[model samples]
Target: MKFKFSIIFSFFLYITYGQINVKGKVVSKSNQPLEGAAVFFNSTTIATITDENGEYQLTVPEGKYKLVASYLGFKTVEREVDINENTSLDRLNFTLEEEDSLLNEVVIGAKKKTKSKKPKYEDFLVFKEAFLGRTNYAEKCKIDNQKALKYYFDPATNTFSVEAKEPIIIINRDLGYKITYNLEKFQIKDRIISYFGYSQYEELEGSKRKKKKWKKNRKKAYHGSLRHFLKTFITANTKEEGFDINIMHRVRNEKHPSDSELAFSKKIFEFQDKRSVPINFNKVIVKPESKLDSAILIHQRQLKHPKIIDKLIKRNVSYSDISYRVEGKVYLKFDGFLKVTYNNEPEEFNYKRDIKRRLGVQKSNFLLFDSPQEILPIGQIADQNNRLVEGYWSYELFANALPLNYKPPKE
Candidate 1:
């Protein structure tokens, strides 16, 4: 089974500058100042905690930003402001109301539920691996809050489902970023995982030496990433950027997917009295092999390596057309997997204790599916219609994500 991410909204982690200034105060609904409130732009490292008087100041580069203010026991607040060379923003105060944090119906036990109504321990383990990830950086990730998650398992169909009542806070010590994630939906069935969520990242404070090391690591993380590939594609620098695309086709499984593979979870009776606890999965029930030829669905099912045809020419691609966004047959979906070859290879160090590896990156090969039409802006590649292949893009998480504004350092 393959697992990958399909980003749906506009999420960015752009770098910030001090050319623009923004100041604000944080207060409660009663007009009482709230000190130590976390405030910052989404995704960027620029952020500040409120002072004793609930006042704060921030100077950033000229750009559009969603300023956020958050405090414990209060609803998070966000305001959008755009800064151009001609103007700057100031005195943007926020009044936060109390927030209601409720666990999912399962956690609060709003209705009667038995042990069988909850997710199995093994299924949950798989969910964690798919969501938090299986990489070294993911290993270093610690979820500050886990109890808020609501889980359910269906054994008859082997489907696991989960959703967070509140945001999931994670500290990525290896990557130097703290992420707050709000999960909207998640499902694991037939060894395949799919999820969509929103998130914000706050850069961790560190010493000068540690910050330097992190800078190197951040650059290393960007290589071969989807964002890296997109920027290069937009600029028509695929060869120089070390990227090659081979359009492969998917051959539909002659035998339609079994009931076990279909996304719908079969119901079960929890008690001897025949109390049926149906798994309430309110999503479109899709066959493991979705039959929409017009809209190609990306799944992680793997068969023996399949055939490849019509390898695209690097010279045929133009600066204006990057394939994923324009909607013709840019990608080929076969019923099976393709034999892939990446022009670039992962980096290998020859010497011990080499920080040089920190300064550079090795390339990785990836296979992902995209929607026939785009759900995001031109810069983003795939939408919900697309499925990420369980390779490089799936492996990389928010820990390594960068914004469209990022530019690789000149070698």
Candidate 2:
């Protein structure tokens, strides 16, 4: 099975009782109002289109956010705002510059018609598994616009990449959401997959019973998720929330053969057996053409283990151990990986069976690429590039995604 990781960052917002009013006007370079411009906070469902006067108003809970203004044919603009009770909402205004139409036309014309190829079924399958994920929720989700996708494969690098001509639309029946994803980048190289994008979510209309089911499903998706973990950690409620965090130390496995050694071994084996067919040089495996290949099979089994050591539990972790507060802002600064187990929920049977682990808890692994990474009050990482997630959180893809503004229903 291929291990996949996604790097998705989008605008999201959450509403609370203590709301701060934010109003803004969008204009052109000449100071003329640009009507119908989109004004919203990045990563939040709270968005509005400017009226005829090119003015928009929003009420959001006090927090730090990236305010954005976008208009067709105009360059998108983003501004960092620290919203609080004392913030001057009226001062929030934006000026958008028109995109160079001539440059856009030139870039479009540069693309060769012969190079454009229709996406194959196999390509879509790969894209779907990487994007929508292989979760049960993903099975109920469908991409509405596959035609917007463009595919490319490089045999030299063994890389497959995709680009979107327009926003990809998805209808998630299980989650009751209509998502519009602006896919900025997607690529699969050297058996590792990564994608990035911004998204807007619209709640699907449904019956009262269906809405109730959606609420329950959303809550299930939220619990034991990355968002829940972050929120619980920030509030110092790990124990109360049934989260067990521990330090996991990982290091390179010295027993793993280096690339040069593997290449040398391959050459020697080929010289000894001319009929041996090399299956994969990366794994140093060859098709057994003779009884002497039994030795190679034994070697392959030894090499099948991971290059990195796992399950090296160091010690228990506390909230203060991984994070600190600076000037009232929360920042995460930690070394090594955090192995978090949510004891409140049991691991899915499918996952448990696949991993062959009897442990009933849901577990995930997290690593920080940068120390002192700021975490917003709403449990969102200020800098997405500062952290890496693996295990369960990484497995749940766009199909299980909830809007930033989504709030758990009261029990």
Candidate 3:
């Protein structure tokens, strides 16, 4: 009798100490078992991952508890249940619904029509018009660069080049010691090609003499900076904000334009300031229409490359019809550039002057010179030969002349 009582007590203690098996299967709304689902009790105490069969088990004290089932891409589900000391739970199950990606859909029961929303003209047009004129100047100029090494194989040779990147913008001209690396400081190579593209203009014959004359008459130069030239050209030619059909896209079976026809067509639509406009136009009529059998997308992606136009030309891109995608971030303005290359090489010396709109002092004003000149002050070199040598640092200029506190021109 004593032995039987001890055995019964031992059995009772074993039953009390044993854990309550909390078993369940987590599944999605589609009734498919979620293999990597997580199951937890009271959000923390007991946690377990679902098996390949979406079944999970957690040994917990026989008490009331909350169970949570979670999986990626699905809404979490929770349940409250009671557990007894000697109870076995039946097939516990969880059903999770896929999380709706668009938040508005959950509250409204359906996605609202986003197509009806007004199109943002500032996203595409304003910057396009502002920078396209630079495209024009670049296309007209003969891009050429010659390395001016005063002495060969000498440390003091003063190696430099002379050329303006496609756009004759002062910022695009680069002349100086091509510092390739720096140990203590982060070495930077001035990248200026961000400004110009294959422009819509003819190469001027006898450009060398013309450039010389322009340099001699710096004060009387028609455009103060390449910026001014481009801004003027873009504003003068483009009356409306629309894609230029000729330069941007190749129309097929369309009304063939006459030789005197304007390549750029003004869109009749007028956009209001701070007001959204609808994007409505045939794809073919879009400024940047993709060619059926071309790599325009590839080229646009690689536009950040220094020699993009050269690469595009190598890939059979037509100089006249190379599409200029006006897609860019908000009004990109560069402080200045250290290097400007044309015809695939760096320029030696160039100079461009910018007037401080408020001060308007012609002399003793900010003279935007090459970075080399900026580092080596020309005034300090007093000797004639030394001054000449220091002054020999020629610079090309690609600048946008703007009045201080410039407001957008009235259309």
Among these predicted structures, which one has the highest TM-score?
2
Ranking of all predicted structures according to lDDT, beginning with the best and ending with the worst:
2, 1, 3
Tens digit of per-residue lDDT, candidate 2, span 1-411: 535364657443433468878998999999999888877776567778888888999888886677878776676777888788888888799999986653213222345222225447778888988888777789989999897777776555666777766668899898888877667678777766787766667789999998988888999988888888888756878778788888877887677766665665666677766866554434444576653354455456446756788755666678887888889777887778888888888766545433545757787888887777877667777677667777777777778878887877766
| lDDT (Cα, tens digit) per residue for candidate 3, span 338-389 | 1111121222211122221332211111112221221111011111111111
For model 1, the run of ten residues with the poorest summed lDDT: 293-302
The TM-score of predicted model 3 comes to 0.23
lDDT of 3 at 9: 5
| Residue 276 Cα positional deviation in candidate 2, in Å, after optimal superposition | 6.6
- Residue 310's lDDT in candidate 2: 70
Model 2 global lDDT (CA atoms, 0 to 1): 0.74
User: Each model's RMSD to truth, in Å?
Assistant: 11.7, 4.8, 34.0
Best by lDDT: 2
How big is the positional error of residue 239 in model 3, measured in Å on the Cα after superposition?
Answer: 84
Residues 119-154, candidate 1, lDDT per residue (tens digit)?
455645556676766655667777788776677665
TM-score of 2: 0.81
Candidate 3, residue 244: lDDT:
19
User: Which of the predicted structures, 1 or 2, would earn the higher lDDT when compared with the native?
Assistant: 2
